[model samples]
Target: MANLFQKIRKGLQLYQQIDMEALEKLAAKVDLNAVVQNVSKLDDTQLQGVMKLLSGSGGHKKKVPPPVDGDFYDLAELLTPEQRALQLKVRAFLETEVQPIVNEYWLRAEFPYELIPKLAALNICGVTYQGYGCPGLPNIMEGVLAMEMARIDASIATFFGVQSGLAMGSIYMLGSEEQKQQWLPAMQQMTCIGAFGLTEPEVGSGAAGGLTTTAKRTPEGWVLNGQKKWIGNATFADVIIIWARDVDDNNVKGFLVKKDNPGFQAIKMEDKMALRIVQNGLITLTNCQVAETDRLAKANSFKDTAEVLRMTRAGVAWEAVGCARGAYENALAYTTQRKQFGKPIAAFQLIQNHLVEMLSNLTAMQTMVFRLSQLQDEGRLTDEHASLAKVFCTLRTRDIVSRAREVMGGNGILLQYNVARFVADAEAIYSYEGTKEINSLIVGRAITGFSAFV
Candidate 1:
């Protein structure tokens, strides 16, 4: 026992003589992997003591990256303080009022009739117009509003687009002074709803060249005949801007047909795969009589109708950004909580790759649309500019939403996850506002001076 005590005393003295500073310098030169392996074998108590000692040491610790926002470029910062605040108000409304009811109404393929007044309270309809109860805001604000609405529910966004962009834009841009004074004020206040009737069962992308719906001048007024399909808000709108070929001039003209017209019938289309909350209709107009006073005075041909389309197509691109942003945000939140193998799946490399790719694409879309809106505000926007944005944004949206669904597995397919609806909605956005192929062709024709559609 005495010999053992002497040996322990010698070991303690030797330990006190060793300098940790000198050893640390030497440790850099040596393969400390052996030391790490030995230290890893230590029991919990020893490791805890070691960690306590090392906690105050000088090595810098690695930091985990922050969670990414779908607006990776922070484009909202470009807005004025007032506009940004308004943007938040709209976002809050969507998150609170719209988000809760969207999945329910979507499941039933019904519109929330109660929301019309609540939405009107925002006073954003006719957002870009100058007078007649409109907000007279900039084009960027209009695009931002569309994005906010779509982030929660694309159907509500579509409903608003038809009312604000397609219907009201046509009147604002092409209606007679009397026509504007008559419908613009009430419609801007949301007391009157409006829809656009341009697409037909036979003509979708060729709306400019091949409208089968016909209108004839009879001294009493004009008679409109033919069928209109996929008309948003048609079943309930107070006024519908129907574009039809004039039998005399062989030119397309616009007429504001009232809902109660005996010859005009709007039947709600059912069993739709997407945007179910939007009340799309198939309208059969058999000698639908529109008074001469209701005809848009400035609309002479399809070229006039294309003016309205040019303005609204850019808004659709912004809507695609919102859809992609919604899906990305939901999937990101899900990944942070969803665990696999006793760790967050987000910690895995592959999951992070998917997330990064989504954010990159989303940021690109947002920035592109931001510039697109800027060009519109500058009056530099053209058909090719808007079409290019629509084509790229909607196509990328499909990819983003699909990845969002993949990340959530089965929950991604369910509407409650917030991603499934976007997935379906993306499909519709892709085809609408001109399909990707058609829009691509439009851009192709612009840049190359070649018409590929033939």
Candidate 2:
């Protein structure tokens, strides 16, 4: 009885030292009775945490955005019924299969190998090539497919581009009948993955004028010695299309570099900020001997290489639009649902202005890429045309993603929100496949009737 009385006296003394006024103010801000009922169920540590949150001193996380429709321009109407069906099919597969695992794989900076066969099952590779188990569809369909892939994940779109556009396009355009017959069918089926080794450690926008990677003709075949950087899928691809400078003719040539060659090595690049899921490689070829039969028959000059770039640039433009569209849709969904001061922040005039600007840019980019693909279908596409689209679409994509990040506030930086990935990837798209400055120069030269590449 004496111990119980002493404990009660100590509790009374501690209660007298509490700040009742501050506690009352905090209690007035929320339902004090409900808070009491909830915290009553908590242990001592949890009750302390609850008090910290009530005082606004604890870590607060922003809410994530919900799933949203990205296509604001309704460009699907332009595609034929079959085309639209295929588009929807690809979109559904991406949303169902890829979306669930993308953030996880991207955070780990690793490729999702299990998805390759599933992508191949779609029968979309080599969409424009004839024969060889290819679809032989129009180029517009190719661009549309790229958009669909990128709308969900840019890294997957890049992997597909390396296979279907760069590697297969090289063989389809420049390889001999025997070479095409040997590789095209398996590649078209995605049974054999391929990569393109064109851009070297030191050569990029000025690749036409200079390439240090050399190929020498010998009795055994051609000996290739050079290094390639940023070769997508190189770490696992069965075959790599290597571009090298022929020492004898002083011309650029393409070679089929087998991944199993004793002299060929590909090291996976690590710690990339953008496109983390893409397995880019730094390849070194030392005395790599190849049979003459494996050399691209028609690729005797750099102009042949430019042809592949011109064809692929349109797809890159479409990818930019898709990335931008994705970010915009996510931002829109977040702003509509997220509240501020008892109202949705999107109701404000300033927020509406940002949203309107993003939509306007997105619509313009879609229409431009749509027409660009139509021109490609008509066989009227020039480097300047594709370059112009590349510059415009990628530039506008930066704007759209920026506004998207702005509207989402702090949640914009979190990968769970999706817009952060788009923002990081837009930087890569802006520079690869020709930088904005290089592409703009191509357009500037065409308009002024004078070359300004220097």
Candidate 3:
């Protein structure tokens, strides 16, 4: 009983360290006699810990969270300082200029013409081309820039790919020096917009063997007839690179069909569920006359058209990465701040699992496309190489966006959330350029050395 009395005196002495007013408030809420009894039961080590905690010397410190970055492997460190700067510049432009109005324009299914001049000012168009006012940067820069653009808006990225990769690449690879001199500079400056016309209502994947659009040679030049569907930028493009079968030779040839041609007609495709900001057009040509001077000078067969597709397919893969990254980042930010059960949803085990899976896929895609661009820059890129990346990245992108939407619940479907846009646009990316089955077959053929593309 004497020892217990001494312990209680020590506990009372510790309580005296606190202000009188604080002790009074604590006494109101807690039974001081009970607390003193409990304190008296503690040994020396336990008493020291309690003293440290009460004095704010050993209490939990506010945690400093790491920044939310999706590049888990830091793949961007591979870029040159200049390239990194350019990438950040493009990202800033998209976030500041495009992000604010994209949902509005996307909702309206209308192109934002105001951004064209702003984009042109970046001087990134025809990024991989060497001459005629082109930037002549490494092909990896092209992939990186495509990612940055699509990270904010896939429609804008599609429009750019059509201009830089498909339209300019056709002329640069197949056109004569004179032809390149005439169009590339103007197109590079974005003063002259261009579109690519290859997919028809009846032909998409079968374009290698079957193009119904026919071009007949005449004294007046060439007369083009047939419909080209899903032509991006066609509604307002100054020039459309129309791939048509030569009537006499029965070979696929490319024509620079000017929008002003008598028979050239482009009608805006309405009510699209994806890529609505892109002014996709259904082009009708009733004897559309393209001058001989305007023909892609050296393009004589579908093999030539395949070259353009191979290059652009790699860009599509990067665009898919961008889409996935956007959705993952958005979902991650949402989870960290969005609370449930009196804590952040991100604190939950299942939410962290979803985020980890997304990061894994996104990291895989980023590294794959990085190497794919290296192959392109080295001149070793093949149809199979590009096809594989397109297949894997887009397929993974669909999964990531779906998971992103699922985590967000009903807000996932709302346009204000932004993941809804990625979910819809991913469907378009997966199907366009090449379907999942088509790209997979391309890879399968290369690996097994068997032509499975029947």
Candidate 4:
């Protein structure tokens, strides 16, 4: 009995230690269950076969052809050299810099403020916007950059999206020249951080028509009174763009609320299961006053708010792609390394199916977002277009991450395997920026000429 136990343990260890190519060949020859069942009865020949499988005999030598990358159809080749270089540069940064410490920070639910200066050096903030020290690249560049960032860490990407896309976008789209001149350059350089507060505690989906936060006109300026929830970066942003309904006209207005305003207090929201690295805040505006000059000049109505949502929604889709891609890549690498029955699990047909399915979904999402950004760059994107991509990509991201975790088995649940973090963060993506149900209804409204978001 002791000898048999030793043999089984040795077989398991050998299987766990072998290279992918040898494991693949071994997986084809034996049923792992049968080996376990016959563990005690196995003779010398069987034990030698098991060891051969683990040792990469039977013509197993190469790295199993690089494990079928998730970018199956070479969609990245569509990118120009400059865009491709940027994507690779960001990917290298995430893998080398962020990947090592993100899990620890996430477990502690703390933001890595130290990474800000390093992130600023990437020079990607306000990427698609022109002027004021912004990159002013095409919209496709923005989507690609978001994808690269999310591919490494979704929380980091969300933090950047709030700062660059939501906050900077408000200023670029609605601020007067002086306002943009005053804020954009510093925000772009990461010298001053920013946040956008649009979702109120009582008015999330209904924010378009019904904002509970009210801005009453005062002789001094505007006295704002309302509560904003899930306001990313509000806790530490130097400036926050608060959206409130005007009490007099009932129209939504945006104000630049500085962090130190006496009436403006932002409390950090805690105990989040996902995107823990993003500093979500519950902002209370009790007579928070803003000068008339601080109000956005062009944002006279909710249509301007919708415009900002439309622009950022596409970036959200790219973030979903990144999250899915991250999970898929990690799962693929893990499966190739973890072994059972004297062979790597990835060599099994069923495991390969899971991997292939994940890749297919990830590839489809990448292609869809790439085209979505192209439409955005050409000035032809619509709300429905962005909504459709958001719906498809986020929905698919959930499936991809689940399969990724499944393929990892027990380790999938552990935060260190990488897929686990993606799985948790994918849930947040599923809920935010319009829930799957809401985004689908938005698309349904466009396609069927029917409103379904009751």
What's the CA RMSD for each of the models?
7.9, 11.3, 3.2, 9.4
What is the TM-score (0 to 1) of candidate 1?
A: 0.88
Give a tens-digit lDDT track for model 3, residues 1-454. Answer: 4564565577567767756677789799999889877977887777777767766777564444567788899998999999999999999999999999999999999999999999999999999999899999999999999999988889999999999999999999999999899999999999999999999999999998799999999998999999999999999999999999999999999999989998999999999999999999999999888899988888999999999999999999999999999899889888887889977788899989999999999999999999999999999999999999999999999999999998898899998888999999999999999899998998999999998877
TM-score of 4: 0.87
Better of 2 and 3 by TM-score: 3
Candidate that scores best on TM-score: 3
State model 2's lDDT.
0.90
Instruction: Give the top-scoring candidate (lDDT).
Output: 3
In model 3, where do residues sit more than 4 Å from their true spots? 1-29, 43-62
Question: Quick one: ranking by TM-score, best first?
Answer: 3, 1, 4, 2
- Residue-level lDDT of model 2, residues 189-282, one tens digit each, is 8999999998888998888878899999999899999999999999999999999999999999999999987689999999898888889999
CA lDDT, every model vs. true structure = 0.91, 0.90, 0.93, 0.90
Clashing pairs in 1: none
Q: Compute the lDDT for candidate 3.
A: 0.93
- Lowest lDDT sum, 10 consecutive residues, model 4, at 59-68
TM-score of each: 0.88, 0.85, 0.92, 0.87
Q: Per-residue alpha-carbon lDDT of model 1 for 1-454, expressed as tens digits?
A: 3453354456545655786666567678886669667666776666656555555543344335467467777899999998999999999999999998899999999999999999999999999999999989999999999999999999999999999999999999999889999999999989999999999999999988899999999999999999999999999999999999999999999999999986999999999999999999999999999899989999999999988998999999999999999999989989988889977778889889999999999999999999999999999999999999999999999999999999998889998888999999999999987989889999999999999985
Give the Å shift of residue 342 in candidate 2: 1.3
